[model samples]
Target: MLLSACSSAERGPVIPFFGAYFPSWIACSLIGVFGAVIIRLLFIKAGIDAVMPLRVIVYLFLAIAIGLLSSILLFGR
Candidate 1:
């Protein structure tokens, strides 16, 4: 499969000095913020319920936190 081939490629080891974990956190935060904003705007424009925006944001944050924590615990210094 394509996925298997990609995994076989020689990706270098993770570099901790770059705050490798930080980028994941930042990306998660940005996605949560932007996604929430866009969803709220769309809901308002369409005159629908506003609760979905909050739920989406919360799920995004949770997912990101879980991923970051797992990575740190698995590859910590």
Candidate 2:
């Protein structure tokens, strides 16, 4: 029971759209996914995608990084 006190009481950032509150993380993640898709297209056009050994992991990390970075910058969390 004492460990529960260590948790933060502040609510996470949210966005209101169409009369509903949406968690900011979801928006950030969607942005990241779209960004990754665009990046992948760019990489393919530049002939960089073929050189990558682990494309899946690379894109996954890129998405997460973009998501977190956008979240921090946009939400200040």
Candidate 3:
């Protein structure tokens, strides 16, 4: 029963919409930049003094790292 459950839990392929037009490296980098811009803008507009620009950059870097790692593991040659 445990083995059956584990097998059943395995996921099928995920189909990306609009197809995989962009390469993972470029896609991840652009997404990171956009996310950083949004975060910085929101923090500034909200007057959140504690949320520095560096924090946004750090968050962006982490996001990009995760994305790149996932791409390499899941789609690399």
Candidate 4:
């Protein structure tokens, strides 16, 4: 049974770009980081960042959420 679970078809999704293969999650994570930076810039422009509590944690989770959502939506992973 364990052997059956190890089929080659079960390999996780990867993206091919520029003659290199990268795991889809890596792309999603980069997008998330970019999104977080843009969001922070917007927040600063609107003067909202200073009012938020635990700003680091909020941004960290925002990046993580963006990464996971993009991963699911873009790669179906």
Candidate 5:
């Protein structure tokens, strides 16, 4: 299937830098955190951010979502 082809069976991609290896997930998750910041900014602009009783939870959720999406897109399933 299309998904099977795209999905990786082994560990996800890794970045080699100066003889060190870093999992790609870390990079994507950081990007996701940045994305969460942008999303929070947008919510603030829309005045919806004020309504959230738990802003941290919402932001964390957004970050996790973005990270997963990035991982899927970059590495595969």
Candidate 6:
């Protein structure tokens, strides 16, 4: 029984919408993807994308960064 008290909490956030529940991470991931798209478009408009040799990899990293950032800001645990 004492060991139970030492266990780390794993209660991640959840959102209930339209009578359904959704994990918060999923929402953050989608937000990250959207942000990545906007950043990509901005880079394209500024003519910076043309100089990047690793477009796909860079975009993937951008999405991951945004996702992690959102998780930190929203979860903060």
Total backbone collisions for each predicted model = 0, 0, 0, 0, 0, 0
- What tens-digit string does per-residue lDDT give for candidate 5 at 1-77? 75785666755589887999998988899989999999999999999999988999989999999999998998885
Cα lDDT tens digits for candidate 3, 1-77: 65785584654434465865444566656555666577657767898736556674577676676666655666562
lDDT per model vs. reference:
0.55, 0.93, 0.61, 0.92, 0.89, 0.89
Residue 46 of model 4 has an lDDT of: 97
Q: Which 10 consecutive residues of model 4 have the lowest summed lDDT?
A: 1-10
For model 4, the superposed segments whose C-alpha errors exceed 4 Å read none
- Between 2 and 3, whose TM-score is larger? 2
Candidate 2 structure quality by residue, lDDT tens digits, 1-77: 87776677756788999999999999999999999999999999999999999999999999999999999999997
Poorly placed runs, candidate 1 (over 4 Å): 1-21, 49-77
Q: Ranking under TM-score, best-scoring first?
A: 4, 2, 6, 5, 3, 1
Candidate 1 vs candidate 3: the TM-score winner is 3
Query: 1-77, model 6: which lDDT tens digit per residue?
Result: 76775565845588888999899889889989999999999999999999998999999999989998998998773
Can you give the lDDT of residue 59 in candidate 1? 55
In model 3, the Cα lDDT at residue 53 comes to 60
Question: Candidate 2 lDDT (Cα, whole model)?
Answer: 0.93
Candidate 5 at 35: error in angstroms?
0.6
- Give lDDT tens digits, candidate 1, residues 28-57: 455555655675577678876454566665
